[model samples]
Target: MKLGIIKLSVLITSVLLLAFQPAGKKPIKVYLIGDSTMSIKDTRKYPETGWGMPFAHFFDEKVAVDNRAKNGRSTKTFLSENLWQPVLNQLKEGDWVFIQFGHNDESPEKVGRYTTPTEYKTNLTRYITESRSKGANPVLLTPVARRSFDASGKIQETHGEYSDLARAVAREQQVPLIDMDKKTQQLLQEFGPEHSKLLFLQLKPGEHPNYPNGVDDNTHFSELGARLVAQLVLAEVKAQNLPLAERIYKPDPK
Candidate 1:
């Protein structure tokens, strides 16, 4: 009878200990760092959405997508403005950092934002190294494509060497890479040029309250475009079989 009581107590103690064990489902944060293509737009901007905005919804409650990308910023400006420090400070193990750039970085015309190819590579390396130092995973994505088409309506490669440089860094650092530039180019090709305009901020005059006269911006994405890109990223995440993929929100088929 005493042995039975002792065994019962031991079992209770074991259950108690197991109950107090640290939870394996601790919430994770995915930090998005880059340019306007991925930044959250102001409410006034309405339909002009950023892919990161829609991306925030793809994960379950156990994940938080913190998009730190800003308009007209590049690797150079993002670091110089001290944007990366706050993210670095908050990083924890099992977190992720998705880094995408180019756009303004490739344009020498953009005085403050242009990051030379060498500097771009160095900056990407720094992001990878620093992110890894925190035990966080770092993903490098070549910038998404700009809307451009040739006479035959074939989408052209707009990122050029910057995308290649990003690829080189990913290869050398052994980081996960989502080739968004190539992926987005294919997406555009699938949509074709005229239909592709549906993905951009192509509003007619007086169509939207904000852009009263109308806007024909190609770099930023419309609502449909943003959601599509976000879905594409999620698909790539699943394809890569990332740990975070398990947190992706899966709806009931029923």
Candidate 2:
């Protein structure tokens, strides 16, 4: 009887220990929805990297970064093409959605993508509302600044009313706002006109095989520029004390 009792006690102890074991950490996902500036670049694009590419590496394994941003996609096209639905479907409770769409929306030349200020505000609100409904947080970011400079070398405001619209939406919805446009413009100003060229897709003729005639695009980011911009966004995340900040990859003490 004593032997049987001892066996029973051991079994009970094992069960108790198993029951008290620590649970595994739940995985958190961050969904990025924006334009080409934040989208992954094609292999042919080479040095024209996007900020989202490096943004994914800043997080720990427990965090998943799903960048669904596409090239030339404005708020209207993003929704019209039903891209947002897939993201909404996959979002679990506690997920985060970063919404940035103003570059293409503000271009009057692009009639199809151009969204009026009212429509832009409504679109942003819809994204925030849907995200909240799914128990997910939505962060609004103004479009990253274009590298435009006047003859006097002052940074120009390229986004116009769209950036303000995003700010208004963030205010109305009580959502977190990252003024990427302002931040990047400040970065450009500090770099000055000549030096700022390094941050963009400026290339000499035949310098890169991708563009034999060479390219001098200022709006797109080079690899270095993309990484810098991603770092800026990460800094904002930390400054805001966002929940995702906890998943940031920090180095162990030396």
Candidate 3:
């Protein structure tokens, strides 16, 4: 009888301990560090959608995506703007940050903002080191594909040298890489330039070039496009075998 009683107590203790163990579902925090392609939105009626908008949907409620990305920003400018500090300060172990830039980082006027191949890789290394120091993992993403096309119906990669630099950064850092530029290019080829244009934010008549008729569009994506890119990102995470990705993908229940 005493042994039975002791066994019962042990069982009870085990059950209680199990119950109190922080729900294995501790939120997996995520921070997005990128350019207009990944920027979070405001109420102001901008026609284009940033990929960050839909990325949050890929994960279960246990994951929080804090998109600190901005429009017309680059790796250098993002730091100059002091955006990384806020995310870095709050980052905890097991958290992840996605860094994608290079869109606006290619122009001559943007030289200070555009990191050359060597400098770009250096910046990425710093991000990785800093994030790791803060107990966060950094994921590098290549820039999104541009709308430029060739007569053969090819979606030209306009980012050029920057795209190569991004790939090198990922390789050198030994970080998970989502080749957004390459993936986007392939997807655009499947879409064809004319139809792919649907993915970009369209502008009304007589807007500025960036606004595309002053209507606000072109470089940015739409909600649907963002969601598609998010899906692709998930796929990339799986391909790269990142641990945090498992939190986002689970078998569907009947």
Candidate 4:
């Protein structure tokens, strides 16, 4: 009888331990919705890396950054591809959806994907609404500036109307905005025109990185450049009063 009682007590203890074990923690999901500049590309032939590749390092492992961004995809085309649909479905409360487009959005040369400011703003609004409906916060990012320079060594603002439109949409939707175009332009201005080329992938003699016949490309960036842009984005997240960002950065030493 005593042995049976001890066996029953052992069973009870095992059951209690199993019941009190803590549940596995869930990862914080961050969905990156953008274009080529923000997507990972096959760089075997090219020496360029997308900013999105390094962006994940800005956050901890608890934060899962799903880079849904693709090459040559505009805001309109990304949606048409049904990329956002799956992201929305998987998203839970407190997740963030970062939308950065406009590189191709303003390319009137590509009418099928090019969008006017009015249409761009409208599409951004819809994205914001959909994200909110799914209990996820939407953050808008202005397109990063291409490494274009003027005669006086000033970095030109290539985004123009599209950047303004993105800002307006962010304001209307009450979302956080990362003005990467302006920030990058300012950085390039500080570096001067010729010197700023260091951030881009330059081709050497008989060395064709992305293009053949020795290209003079200035649009894409190298790994270091991508990391710097990602750092800027992290800084912007801290500046924008995003709750999740608070843990990522320490107090400024200044």
Residue-pair clashes per candidate: 0, 0, 6, 0
Candidates in order have lDDT scores of 0.94, 0.94, 0.81, 0.83
List the candidates' TM-scores in order. 0.92, 0.92, 0.84, 0.85
Compared with the true structure, what per-residue lDDT tens digits does model 1 show for residues 1-254?
Answer: 99999999999999999999997777999999999989999999988999999999988888999999999989999999999999999999999999999998899999988999999999999999999999999999999998999999999999899999999999999999999999999999999989999999999999999999999988899999999999989999999998888999998899
- Write model 4 residue lDDT over 51-142, tens digit each, in one string: 88898877665788899998888888888889878888898988889999999999999878898788898888888999999889899999
The collision pairs in model 4 are: none
TM-score of 2: 0.92
Better of 1 and 4 by TM-score: 1
Can you write out model 3's per-residue Cα lDDT over 1-254, one digit (the tens) per residue? 99999999999999999999885787779999988888877656455678888887778778999999988887788888998888888999989999998877777677567666676777777888899898888898888887778999988887888878878877877877788889988988898978887787755675534454454355778777788888899888888788876788565897
Which of the two candidates, 1 or 3, achieves a greater lDDT against the reference?
A: 1
For model 1, the stretches where C-alpha displacement exceeds 4 angstroms are 1-24
Mark the 10 consecutive residues where model 3 has the least summed lDDT: 208-217
TM-score of decoy 3:
0.84
lDDT of 4 at 177: 88
Least accurate 10 contiguous residues by lDDT in model 1: 21-30
Candidate 2 ranges beyond 4 A from true positions: 1-22
Which candidate would rank higher by TM-score, 1 or 3? 1
In model 1, the Cα lDDT at residue 23 comes to 78
